[model samples]
Target chain A: MCPAMGDVDIDSRTWRLLEPAGLTWRCWDDEYIVFHPWSGMTHYLDAIAGTVFELLLDHDATVRGLAAALANQADTPATDSLNVAVRQVLRRFDEIGLAEPIP
Target chain B: MQLGAVPESALRARFRATGVRLRLAGLCINLRTDVPAVIEQILQLYGGYPLEPGAGTDDARVHLKYASPLRRFIGRRTLVFVDGEPLYRPMLLRHAYLMIDSALDWCVSANVTNLVLHAAVAERGGLAVILPAPSGSGKSTICAALVTRGWRLLSDELAVFRAADGRLQSFALPITLKNESIALIRQWAPDAYISPVFTGTIRGDMAFLRPPTDSVTRAAETAEPALIVSPTYQVGAPLALQPLGKSEAFRLLTASGMNYYTTQRFGFDTVAGLVDSCPAWRLSYGTLEQAVDAIEDLLARVRMDPTASRPAITTT
Candidate 1:
């Protein structure tokens, strides 16, 4: 079931995210280890965080959509906690140049 | 034909004229030196390696000679040249073999595309056991012991891992014994071929044990990783081997591997696969005997029960 998200900013709703160009990644047991060539940093990501990047790689995804994608991967319904986690992970991705939220 | 198959006269003539090219495992080295002791060391230490038959480009070109006429006679110093450029400071002329070892180390660590880790490697049953530790942690000492105990030596200084298949490539160079280890190995394995100790080298009283013939013969073989053990030698400490988690193993490998960050995501995947496929542990031991025994026991257990060491990975 999808919940109403009138309170959340539109910027977080329709924000387009994608992996940085030339980034590399590997996954083990659903956990992702990603390397950012520009920054020369290796990040360890849990299953949910990994799903977020995978979802964005195919097409631009919004926060709500990202949460839904993660839920689908895990074979569960999207929860409020999943949405909050997605938002936090996206902020981290932005800082690391892993993904950009474009207009 | 192997280097040993070539007569000393032919090797000497080759060394004096063009260079003596020796192929060891995946690397080919063309060495040019006329120094009698250096030549003797090469013929003696590298006797088991195959002679590079002018087939492909040599991976490294190293030349060792007296620094200058003045220094050659005065301090008796030698300079190491790689690709026609002097790469290291002049050291005692007697340190020519050390220069060769150092030059080869530089060549592979800087040039090879594989992810290089400063570790010792040995293989048994087609599985490589990687011992990645900082220098002076008794890595070579233990590695030499294992080789003497009939384990095939993959490498004593560098563990080169290919990213495509996550397998360890054999680099069966000599096992260097340093300082106290020099006397220790001689006493432990009297039959081992050890070079005469050269004092005043950078590492202090360094000697190299020639790699076994079997290891040199199988240098082209590659082995998938089965175990990664980080050793810390302590005096009077009881032998202890503790399980190291996968995340921690990945962290340690990234820290020690030279090209780990440069290879980016491929490097991450290579190491991740290695960690997931093998069980890692931290081993602490006081005596060489205890360490060897423990490692052999671990190998036996893993052989009997393959799944005991495999880490669990959740695909969903």
Candidate 2:
């Protein structure tokens, strides 16, 4: 079985949806995606801060749980490379007005 | 009590008749008849004022004045009347409509060989600069200042290009200055035919400054595109130019162009050619005077060396 082909539910309150232009994305809120139709550009938010995002979308986990989730993501020596990558992506999202925090 | 196709000649004849006042945002307008109701409709959107009825002329023409929305058509022709005279609104609207409609048609009818840009353009010593920015970006204010500082005002707030020859067409509209910028230019250019103040717009009480008279009659002529700069009204800051890469410039230019996507084959090429042809930059600054000086220096540099590209300057 192809592991990538299977449905990977990281958590609740976080599900993946295909955007208007058919870009696959996982988000906690609508503001994470910026749709500039004229320029034909779509930007994703909270992508860099994957550790924090993954926890929230993972079964609607809370902030404290997110820190732990990030820590766990960091602990995996084999797959932990995604931790730094996730943080960078999240920073880029913030810089471009693609990310927002839930109040 | 009149209707039907109001052509220019008929309008000329009507201007020989009863004159009325049309007003918008405190500007008085004078127009001949045969102007459409659409122009009047636009003026009404601002604040329609009226002249003292029958003050137009001896032809029994209705002399009117009113406040006008500082507007430009991506077309040919420039019309300016006294600020806040309601008696001339209809005629003024008609004049604006005729000019705008014709210019728009000229751009489209000529085999898609022209691009009508919603920007302010001017040149000095044959070197030109086109300012393309979204509304409220202080483009008009800077252009007005440059023209007064001796730059030829090719256009006050639009950049029409005859793509057939890759030459820039000129416009006769006034330099539409808003808020503090309007007063600033008035103080800067003594020869500037400043109009009365207009207040209460979504963008603040905007006033327009008349561009050089030569620009009006020379609408058919075109200039080669040189520096493409975007201006921002960030007060109390020094003027600076920032680099604009082709890709980023294309994104912003296409975003700002009025009809880039409307003309199909030509639209794409026009935008592509422009981004490829001219060097673009982000000119961010607060005060109008500082921006004016920076643009003047850039213009001087462009004219002195036709091939010289102004170094990119960006202000934080």
Candidate 3:
């Protein structure tokens, strides 16, 4: 079964992009267009989701870690709301087979 | 020699016997049809296109002929054959022109050498503007308007893009206008030549506008894409031209592509390179004049400085 955000321990899990080498993508205007060869689908990701995707491409990260990175990039504090937003993006990424949590 | 120069009797004999060979957008098409209406329409609409030598190999061979004597007598149906195989169900004989037009488009799209999109392409100052939209979205209407206004008609139906260099090859076939647009064009350009309207077909009241002689004569030229516009015609809406981001442009181009999926990675790279090199916009206008003027203005700006016209998109 696919793990939902509510069912998984968000603080203990780290997510990595699925098939990073196979996915082709280009970023423009802070938005991302990705072509997933596995699914044969082209996905458009907005700023937040695109940022999260870019991070996942580089290395694995937890929700809190991603929130901190986003906060640093935007020159803001890693608040509870930011962490919540990052978690939501991660959940969507999981749903789309873009990222999967390590067992 | 052009198709129009051939005498009626000789044309009929050649079409019935050896097929009429014509050059269209750098490809030789050998079409054989005995239907008088199809022949007459070709003589009128394709008068300026160059005729190829009959002895050489052809890229496509098409035949539009009456179905069985019983079917023709009772139903007045015709069949379209590409390479001696029936392409679709028998259509009304009145729609033979439409079937042949669509079959020619299919032949070009089926070609593996070029990536084709369902778009209207025109050129000015050696640069091309691609108008990609769905049917009834005023694509053909706007394309017809632009051609009448002095833009070279690269194509009114398909945008044939060469993947090797990302250039648009010309396919200046006749512009197929449907329903109200036929009268609209006739009223707008009184001197334009339009075929007799074939009523009660599947596309609903269709007619074709003969492409300009200059476009037909210069069919071998290719133009680099300078701008991409997705147009929409809304009744009573004011003219609006909005800058489109590259990602969105890529999405639109790929969505409109006729054989993008089959072309695979080459399609991806070529489309990406096109969006990178050219700027794109979303154009909506109630009046044709406004859209044409806005496009001309954009083209002027692009000619002046292409970098400034492109939408500012900084990679993350």
Compare the candidates by DockQ and give the number of the best one: 3
Ranking of models by TM-score: 3, 1, 2
Residue pairs clashing, model 3? none
Error of 1 at A35 (Å): 3.3
Candidate 1 wrongly placed segments (more than 4 Å): A1-17, A20-32, A36-40, A45-91, B54-57, B310-316
TM-score of chain B of each: 0.93, 0.64, 0.94
Q: Write model 2 residue lDDT over B1-316, tens digit each, in one string.
A: 1112234344345453643333211123343433344344323221212233436422122222222334334332234232222322233332343333233223232323356677888876666788988888878888888888777777666677775765676654455677888777888887777655556644566665655645543445567788888888887876667777665676676676666656544555566566666767789887767777776766665666656443543443
Q: Rate the local accuracy (lDDT) of all candidates.
A: 0.80, 0.53, 0.85
Ranking by lDDT: 3, 1, 2
Q: lDDT: which is higher, 1 or 2? A: 1
Error of 1 at B92 (Å): 1.6
What tens-digit string does per-residue lDDT give for candidate 3 at B1-316?
Answer: 9998878899888887889998887778888988888988888988888999879999999999999768757888999999889999998888888888888877766663678888999999899999999889989988998998888999887888887687899988899898888887887788999999989987789998999988988888889899998899887789888888788889889999887776766677778778888889989988788888988988887888877647443211
Model 3: how far residue A1 lies from native, Å: 12
> Which one wins by lDDT: 2 or 3?
3
Q: List TM-scores for all candidates, in order.
A: 0.81, 0.52, 0.87
- Model 2 error, position B291 (Å): 1.7
Higher-ranked by lDDT: 1 or 3: 3
